[model samples]
Target: MNADRTKYLNRRALMGAAAASLGLAAVPALAQDNSTEMDAPSTGPVHNNTSSFRMLDWRPYFSDTRNGAILVDTTSRALHFWSEDQSIYKLYPTSVPLTEDLTRRGRTEVVQKVVGPTWRPTPAMKERNPEWPDFVPAGPENPLGTHALYLSWTYYRIHGTHDTRKIGRRSSNGCVGLYNEHIAVLFGLTKVGTQVLLV
Candidate 1:
């Protein structure tokens, strides 16, 4: 009976180890599929392009200290406006919509800044928003909102959007979307040579 009990215990231990190994082997396959899902493009047609969107009321203040540029943290959904002279000046919540396979980290310069900018959909964007006019005029109706900080990259712009609700969510086609009032403050703080660090 003693020998039988030892054999039974060993068999149970071996079964448990085999089960754990099977689970470990399955993990890589599941991880691979999850990555593939994230890489997929978002579905559905683009929504309305009207300026009926309400703008956020933002109040702006400046510090005498000159911070060099801006840093946008998409994961944390925050924007840090720093003065070159000081470590920090202002911080605002922001949002970025990314593709499933998208990955961006580190810093880049802001090459240009525009106020009340127009929206010119890229050929790819146009394909997605066929109903979108060739150019959207500047105003409350414009998706670009009241300010835009053009990044070093041609197509990517950090701009205010009429869609204020998107500020905390990952929802933009690719651009960084800010609240109208927050963007206006950012516009005042930054210039063509501003550095944008994304992490």
Candidate 2:
């Protein structure tokens, strides 16, 4: 099989498993904070430096226009943003990986947009990193670098991370990660209700 096709199959299998582990009907609406009622099964401890893998070479898939919402292709590691005219004009290569579990695969709605967003460690995250700050104020050091689009799903976000070298690689715990500058560009074009498709 082609490399892309093989990657897609692997992702599909992971998504299937995740969906089975978590009841499909119980999936909660996406929310801004990670403190939502729906709890995602613990996927083992998250490692901070999982981005050791090199980024694959992939061109961004984009719409012809720039006014619509964004859709991320986790398998291909690309982000597509549609325009008002129903064209996808902006595309960014992504390094973040979706959670391998099927429960994390599906459509989500962007509920909020924040620039220079702060990073707050969730209870789960805090457990893994005891030294993690209660909150990292927005700035160069913040995990959420310059832009963040909050999805309704708890503990998941489409945001800019400091790991630009990891773009086009599997790195994030479950969120869609982008480079700081790229996310800043995406932040300007997106709004609430932007549909996020993960396949």
Candidate 1: list runs displaced more than 4 Å: 1-67, 101-104
Candidates' lDDT values, in order? 0.61, 0.61
Per-prediction TM-score to the true structure, in the order listed: 0.63, 0.62
lDDT by residue for model 1 (1-199), tens: 6999999999999987896775533332312211010111235433332221111111122323233656666666666666666533566666565443334556577888888787776677667657766777787767777888887765777888776766666656667777888788778867677777675
> What is the per-residue lDDT of model 2 for residues 80-149, given as tens digits with 9 covering 90 to 100?
6665575335666765543465227666778888877877777766676566577777777776667888
Clash pairs, candidate 1, are: 38-100, 51-141, 66-83, 66-84, 67-82, 67-83, 67-84, 68-83, 68-84
Cα RMSD to the true fold for all candidates = 15.6, 14.5
Residue 66 in model 1: shift from native, Å?
8.6
Model 2 lDDT, residue 144, Cα: 67
- Alpha-carbon shift of residue 158 in model 2 (angstroms): 1.2
